[model samples]
Target chain A: MAATTKGDAGRSDMPEAMGAGIRIVAWNVLSLAIALVIWQLASRAVGSPFFPAPMQIVDAFIQLATRGDTTGHSLWEHSWASIERVLVGFGLGVIFAVPLGLLMGLYPKLYAGTRAVIEPFRFIPPIAWIPLAIIFFSGLTRFAFLIFLGAFFPIFTSTLVGVARVEPIHRKVGIVHGASKLWILRHVVIPTVMPDIMAGMRVGLGTAWLTIVAAELAGGISTGLGRMMINYAELIMVPHVIVGMLLIGLIGFLMNEVLLLIERRLFRWRWQVSL
Target chain B: MHAPISLAKVDVDASHRYGPLTVHDGLKFSVAANEFICICGPSGCGKTTLLDMLAGILVPSSGHVHIDGTPANPKKHSISFVFQEPSTFPWLTVSENVATGLNIKGAPSDQVRSKVASIIDIVGLKGFEDYYPHQISGGMKQRVAIARAFATEADLILMDEPFVSLDQPTREHMQREVLDIWRHMKRTVIFVTHNLEEAVYLADRVLILSAKPARIVAELPIPLQHPRDPLSTEFTEIRSKCVQWLHASH
Candidate 1:
């Protein structure tokens, strides 16, 4: 829609979202083209068996997407497996972390009681827990546990900070309005911190995705992107390994975009600093 | 014999200290039902701190606030505090902001709608009800604040220099708006401001306080007519007297 309001900075023929979309797609294509050219030139000059040209990696990826290739499963299957682990781990992390974090933010005493346990545990790397996770849970649950460990603390800490950042005066307004503790949490506290919570979910999901790939290699999982890369590397299939790495990066970008879309839909009132 | 109406009170040597220095001490006062009172003092003399104490946001180290002989409590009596700073919630539109108190109180949807609309009109914000805080100017946000305060019809409204941030013209305009709402609603209001003229213009009684360790220095009563002419002899006489007390305390 062409804006009728004054002082709107006037519009071009193109809608703002469309204009921004064109610019982003143009930049992405140009950058990817340049990178592919550089990789091809570098590989042709070096002439090493270790490094494959961009075309070879794309062919390997196409092979995975079309047929089972060496892994006996399509690329879709590996991607889906990785995504399932991330979803389960991220979902479990959010279900417990958000409420617990909010409670801790509201009540310092609750935070104090749990601080000692969480503080030391958060410092340990998620991959370090692979041994314990495998011992505790078998198969898929073990991989999920590693992803959960990666996702939990970031979401928890972000929620805690966001809740604590709510303006004191806003709470006073709720208090004076006779809003109950529960009512205030729902209406006043939650809305104020929602943007942060959504952002944390995006971050936590990304972390879980990254952790899941690493966990798959160590957790004896045979059907994920990480496991596929390991299997190919053992066979000295360099192009296949590069294909797995690139797919992980592409999928990660797509997941973040999905979360950003949701964040924008939910928090319309929030204004981001733009160019 | 029982009093006809119960009002709120603040007494019992209420004071605050920052380490060694005291901000207020022996600050005792009481307000009558439906009265418009102003606590006037020098700048940074803890006028806002006094309102916070009454609103239960800040608990006085020693004294207590009472409503109808019971300690002043938000759960017991409806109390609203309007801060001097523009306190409109940015995420909520004007109508939503005004409707919040009523919605929290569990009013019917129709009642909330009507009350919000009526109060928005009363505060001269009918058209801007859909506007967010960022979409409007500072003074309009003040109107939203007023509408929110009046809509609640709280037993007591504590205002800590609510219009002090506006420009001179808008400040005067808002002062009259506040007086109109206070008169029509007949709700007890304890306004805190550093300006003597504003105190004389709006308050039925002005509680003048000392500079530091602010305590009630004097209580000046104003029987002046409504829509008071600032240039009139009566208004200036009262304003000057309040000013003298404020200066002397400083």
Candidate 2:
């Protein structure tokens, strides 16, 4: 019976699983539709100015896309402002912290030198840095500082962990092959640590998004998702405020999707094994 | 004709205030150029730890390791190791992993490419040059490990139970592959394993060890030629002799 079942499994599983792509798309559409229907019903029942209907938010979205009335910036411009802060801040954090983390992981002295400073600071939320960041840095630099603080520790800590986690046997392979310490770091340690680094980047970027919203709301930004949401809410444009919040959610989701795509491409070897 | 590597009076102790625990003590051995030697013992008999002391990855509490009759220094001596679990750089393709040692040794570009290609082909990984380690089977990974060992043309090659993790069929195939590579390259090899059959199958000389404090108990030489059949009487006789020595040690 087991032998017959094994023979039948090959014929049964192949064609049905062939179009996984189409099945995924179909499932996603169904899930989204179910969500929208529930949200539409809930909004209509609330019937409050604070809670606008789904259709009202959609209409407000169309209006914002076509015209930038109150702030004199396009909806795209506001979204772009938030995205720019995320990129510059996250980029600065990555460039500065990755190498430092790698170095600290390799050399004990470096880690010992900076451990006291980093351990305390890593615990503080990025939102807490907004007031001090405004004083220390002017305008866009202030927002950048906030985002960088949010992103830096995650990326740095992961890099350190990743480097430390490299198997001893792998390093032994390099040593036995007569590779120098520097050569082993470049060829073996760095490559082995990359997947962990990428995972850290994804997490750090999420924190950057969260911090940017808080920063824009509190730091008195002229144009951004958080600023737009606050400004429209004050003006009693409830639908527009909802539109701003949803836009932020959508844009953050898209950015994460792109990062995941890049990671999947970079680490294709990691997932391709049938064994 | 000269020995490329030798270890004398090596000792590793892990005793506490309460009692005594000596892992290895006074191990003395030598490997002649181009000789394939196997270190066989019961499990946890410090075979791999022995390899580590020889490779300078681990320092024995007291010992002398010599390479080319000089004090052993990794930077001065070229030695290759094939770990029990192959350590191919996950990010590197099969050819790149094969080329790594050669590049570090500063081989010319043309030489690196040809040598890497030839070694990959020799290991029956011709079509897998572009494949990553994760995409291949465990047996294929060990083949790459052996290929890397041979490609560097090191003075000594230390293998720590490289095929013990593999299935019987794959183990037999890899043993043959190792023999084939040894014949072609003619580098000194010290392979460590717990399996007596595996030791008899591959080694020119099997150095059997006692249970703990792990001293070398006996040297059993196999005069059978390459590609020796495991089913043959001569093979079984030698295997039995090695097993008897191990049982006696216990």
Candidate 3:
């Protein structure tokens, strides 16, 4: 009886559930269509070449897909460049940050001792390190370094908070079962903090993507959507620049959606929705 | 397996203090192997604190707890627990949660699979083994906790008011199931509860404690056969006796 209530808790009434979903989809489409129409009219009225209308941006998007960018690199190539950097940086950040965060969380004295060193770097924006990155590193290393800086803090902090917030009973359960320290760390601590770690990784991916784009925009990278945008802007091809911006926004949204999907699948036991 | 394992003889002579406030004042007790003991006390009487001492989660300020003539070390003796809260690991499915203790003890995969399968069956959670904790009702989650504790095959199992959160009917139902499991497993259990009927129904003997800075006020043996009826004259007689002793302590 209780199980049925819990299963029904978040669901709409049977008759209304399907209707509600359709209504939501219709409303979203209508809202976006209305906004685009308004923007197109406003841009035409202004008649500034730099402010391309929505249709012009769409035309440029198709052109980029078929004709390639100013440097002859296709749209897919630019996107993959930025995406590969984000994944590499984000992956490396997670590998190092999560274990470090877990260790710091488990031992308070270690966290306290390292706070002075870690806290300062976290406050510094990734963009501010561009000059240093360019000077000390070359090629992919330079981009990876900046993107790593952007992604590392969120993942580390989230894991630390996750560890700290772990239920005392969870640890006691492990201890009572005669779990060794390593055993408890693996079975109890890691599993208990998984949701938080996933949350951190999601946020870190966003920041890493942002940092990679910024680094590409700052130049030295011949590829990526950001570099493609700069190349078009230099030639004053406003429509192509708008296309690059739109593509970045679309990809970021898609990336976040992918992570959200994974989160939903992995943590089906959690009560609240991430959104 | 129905016979006692002959290991879990617990001797506790301990006192605990949280700064200036004393929680257990020279509290001393002993539990025999396979004996089902219930520690009943008033609110804020530190029944959980006593269990923590027994579990080795908290060390007594001034005395020792020995299991089978050895010092109470969780690493040395297989001690399992069932907490009042919903403690099934949320990330693990029902079967995985039950297998936790055995997995930690490095039991072979085949042994873990069979033991977990049978324990889940005993607890009436056979079909729900693939489900997560949030998918189950609170009573069902408690059953999982019980199954996990039993599957561990611990020398001693500590239950701190493990059914206090359930509805009355569910609580009574769990009490009967717990008795059934105890009969088959023969693991020494020290259950702590404030409910008089619960203490009377489940325990071979009940230890009643006084108010703050608690001490054992009385120790009453149930002496009744298995499947004791709650409405029977003998059951109420002992319950009233416990109430009198509890009131007198205050």
Candidate 4:
């Protein structure tokens, strides 16, 4: 009986699973369509300019994409401005944080010595630093400083955790093999901590995105998604503001997806234990 | 055939303490070059601490461990290890893991490549050179660890219950494979385990250690040769002697 059932499983399972998959996708589309219809109806019934319909936002999206915004910067330019700031700030944060984290992890004394200064600043939110950041830095530096403040702690903390979590046995392997201290750092310590560092980077990227948006909105930056949203908000162009918000969401999601892809590629050796 | 590397002769007269708590007191032993020495004891015995001192990872609170007339230092001595836990670097492929020591020693690329290839083949991992540790089974990962230790052609090889994690069949198989590798390579090995049967099966001489503040309670030499049957009278005699020593210490 078991053999017969097993033999039939291959022939019977494929289309049944495929049918379920198709049903799921169809349900997703239907649910989204219903939500959009409700949104459209609510906007019409309210007759408020603030509550723009989905189609109105879509029309605004096309308009912003084809023609320049009020400031003559295309939607792509605004997005590029936001992305460029994020990349610079995030890149700098990773470069500084990972090595410092690794060093601090290896030398507890270093962490101990600096903990007093680092801990308090880490707790202070990056948004709180906007006024000081604007005063201290100008242009890209201001944006980078704010974003760096947001991104730095997560990457650094996780890398520290990664170092702490490094298996003593693995380090013992290096020691027994007579590997030099630098070689152990490069080969054993770095590789062991990579997955943790990658996880930290993912979190840091999200924080960086949020920090850049807030900085752009408040720092009086001339060209960014947040800046464009503010411009529309002042003019009572709610649809364009919605377009900016959605664009921010879409871009943030895509950046996260890219980092996730890289994480998967980097840690292919990680064991996947299933119950 | 290439010349076999000179094996290390170890001499230990060490006592270790942890914050006023003694782990091993006056634990003295010596391993001859090319000898297979297994140390077994009850749980909480300082078998691993002994290995750590020999590997130069920890210094004894009193006395010293010497390898070939000098103080034991991993940097000064040629040593390799197979740990109780899975210690293969997950980022490296099988070939690279095997090649770790040689690469660290700054051996020429060709030498490393050949040594890694031959050792991988010896361990029956030839087809899996590109595979990572996580891609392999538990037994296979241990095999990789074993191959890596041998590939270094180190003078002293320390294994702390390298096969304790495997089930019965795989453990038995690995025991035999390890014996063959030791016979072929002829390095001084200090293997630590808690299993009496495993020690009896593998060691030239089994060192039964007493419980904490651990010291060698008994030495049971297996007069039986390689591929000795566990059912054989001498094999059982040696195993029971080790068990007796363990029970007496407790």
Candidate 5:
């Protein structure tokens, strides 16, 4: 029976398993629909100026995409602005954080000595730095600094943890193989900790988006999704507000999916294990 | 291809003054080329420590491990080692793991690939080349480890109970596979194990060591042919002698 099963699996004529793919997409769409239904019902029952029905929000989204009123900017324009800020800030954060994190991880004494200082700084929220950032930098740069601060700690901490957690046996294996210290770091240490780094990057991406929105709402930036959302809220254009929120959710989801796809492809070896 | 590896007047003395305990004291041995030597004893015999010294993973306090009449160096890829555990890199596929040493030496990509393919085939892991270490069974992972050691093209391969984790059948199968690979490759192997039958079956000569602060107690030659039958009279006689020697020591 096992041999026959293997034979069938090997046959190119047989169709690949499409069931798992269908199930995942169906589940996601169904959950989203359920959430929208609950949201719509709540909006109608409350009858509040704050909450708008799903259809009303959809109408607002359409207007923002086409008409571009109140904020006086199109949805695409705001999205591009937000995305650009995130990319710049995230790129800088990764550049600075990874090397520092690796150094800290490799040297225990350094990590120990700085723990007292790092702990308190890590707890300081990115939004709390908005006032200081504004005073420090002029316009978009201030917002970028906020995003960088938001993303930096998580990536740094996760990288440190990943490097520290590299199995001793793997290091021993490299040494036994006559790998130089640099070779060990480049091949064994880096690849071993990649899954953790990818996870950290995912978390950092979310934090970057959150900080971008918050920084824009702090009213320094002239153009951003958060600025548009706030402007629409003040004008009582409920649809544009909902549109902005939906756009944030959609973009965040897409970015996360992209990261996840990269993770899956790069670490296919990891996924082969059942556990 | 090269002169036999010889250890002359080798004395390893490692001691710590921790109130009243002396860990290691004055140990000596020499191994020849193409020698399938098995170092067997009860647990805590420092068999692993001896193997580590041979592989140059650890340095002896007062002696040297010479490979082809030269002192062994950890920085030199003169020796390959396989631990009892699955030491194949979890992040690399079977083929990639096997070719890692060659890649580290900056060998050409095509040569490394071809060597890896051949070794994989030799170890009966041809179809599982693309599988990661974790995807495979324990026995298969050990095979990958063996294949990796063979692919390194080192003159000496040191193994510490390479099949200790497998079931009896799988262990026997792996033992045979290892012998076959060794015969074809003609590399010197120093296998450390406690299993008497395994030692007699695989080794050209068995070096039995005493319990603690291990010293070589006896050296027995197994004049059995290749693909040794464990149920054969000669195999049983050697096995009983080893069992008797170990039990008699206690």
Candidate 6:
């Protein structure tokens, strides 16, 4: 009888927990639905080729995803191409940015001295460099450069901010405990700055996506989703364009979710309060 | 009592545009091995400055803070400190925080684990070892701080108003815990605080100081036993004497 009562209580608690999660998901879906409704109404009222209705967009999306060679390529092929460019460019940016950011963070004097040079370049839009990138690099490299430029600044700046704001008390504690400079940086400073770095990476990922689209349009990269999107626009095929847009949003959301999951797992100590 | 640490004719001075501020002017004192010495003074009277000097976090302009006949060096890690706020790393679990000193020293993993577990248990946080600083109550956080200090195995521990943030009841409870730990470990402690009752409750001797450009005004040795009743006559007498000395100096 006691075991049955305990099991009932456990079952009851599970629903409460699940209810909170469901509420969050429901709220997000409601907002998306409201946005779709607004889009549909606006499109119907205007009745222009540019603004398609939500159902029409959905129908287009299904056609593009299912039909091969909708815009001289399938949706899968286009998505694969876009993912390839973004992954390559973003990977290169991270390789360069992380170490540079760490150096800038660790050595404030060096960072301060170089700020005059780095800050102006950071403000220049990645798309603004399209002409110069074309002049410098050929083919895929030009698009990659634009993507790299787009992703670099946010990650670097966030890393610098994170490293700079490491609590003084934590450093003092490390000193009192006889930690060497390297040990303190690795054990205390790095861990404290990780969440900020992760936030920067998220922002960088968004920037990379935006820049890739512009790069693909400007440079005429033959295989990417961006090229596919432009080609669909040129052909007045609204469905293919909608499909590409949806895929971009979905992929970005999935990437962020993956990072969040990793963050939660690796830094469980940070989120112990919620548990 | 055998003098384990001593300062003689110690002079610390700082000069600004507004003349000079003297922190310790010919300050002379001796602390016996395993003694609980609480230094009490008004705010800005350099009680913390004095503790910092002793801990070797600061260099006195003109004097030396000697530990076991050598100048105190913070880099040596001979003196462990518990600050006004619990200084446990927010990113680390209680056990990891406690084991940090050992980790820095590059002790073997098994030794660090066993020592941390024992210290956590000693601090009455057996089950909460896996908990992070934010997950624990303030009192529990302070307990973890205390456990970390104890676990460091440093012969001399310095504390700067460690219980100043706690409620009165919790503070009193922490005072007892500190005394109990001191009794069992027999480690020399130098505690600095602004609270008269706390100074009386914890110290073998209380050193009262004057206001800024501070100097030691009076040193009162409490002839009380462990687990002292605050209501007792001796406790009241010493407490009043320390308060009076503080007022007179100001």
Q: Give per-candidate clash totals.
A: 0, 0, 0, 0, 0, 0
Question: Sorted by DockQ, highest first, which candidate order results?
Answer: 3, 4, 5, 2, 1, 6
For every candidate, give the share of true A-B contacts it also has.
Answer: 0.44, 0.63, 0.68, 0.72, 0.46, 0.46
Model 2 per-residue lDDT tens digits across residues B1-250: 1232432222223211113667776766676667788898888877777787667666566656666666555566777888887688778778888888898899999998988888888888887787777667778888888888878777778899898779998888888888888787777788998888888889889988887777778988899997888899999999999999999877
For candidate 3, lDDT tens digit of each residue in A13-45?
445656777999999999999999998999999
Q: Pick the TM-score winner.
A: 3
Highest lDDT scorer: 3
Interface root-mean-square deviation, each candidate: 4.1, 7.5, 3.9, 8.0, 4.0, 7.0
TM-score between predicted and true chain B, model 6: 0.90
Q: Candidate 5 residues A32-52, lDDT tens each?
A: 899999998999999997788
lDDT tens digits, residues A69-183, model 6? Answer: 5446777887887777788888888888877888899899999998899999998999999999988997667767888999999989999889988888788777776778999
lDDT at B15, model 4:
93
Task: List the candidates ranked by TM-score, beginning with the highest.
Answer: 3, 5, 1, 4, 6, 2
DockQ of 3: 0.52
Q: DockQ score of candidate 1?
A: 0.37
Candidate 4 TM-score, C-alpha based: 0.89
| Model 1 residue B139 CA deviation in Å | 2.6
Q: Candidate 5, which CAPRI tier?
A: acceptable
Point out where model 4 deviates above 4 Å: A1-34, A271-275, B243-250
Assess each model's interface with DockQ, reporting 2 decimals per model: 0.37, 0.42, 0.52, 0.46, 0.46, 0.33
- State the C-alpha lDDT per candidate: 0.82, 0.80, 0.88, 0.87, 0.79, 0.78
Cα displacement (angstroms), candidate 2, residue B31, comes to 2.1
Candidate 2, residue A66: how far the Cα is off, in Å: 3.0
Worst 10 residues of 6 chain B by lDDT: B9-18
lDDT (10s digit) by residue, model 4, range A156-261: 9999989988788787788888888898898888988888888898889999999998899894678999999999999999999999998889898898888777
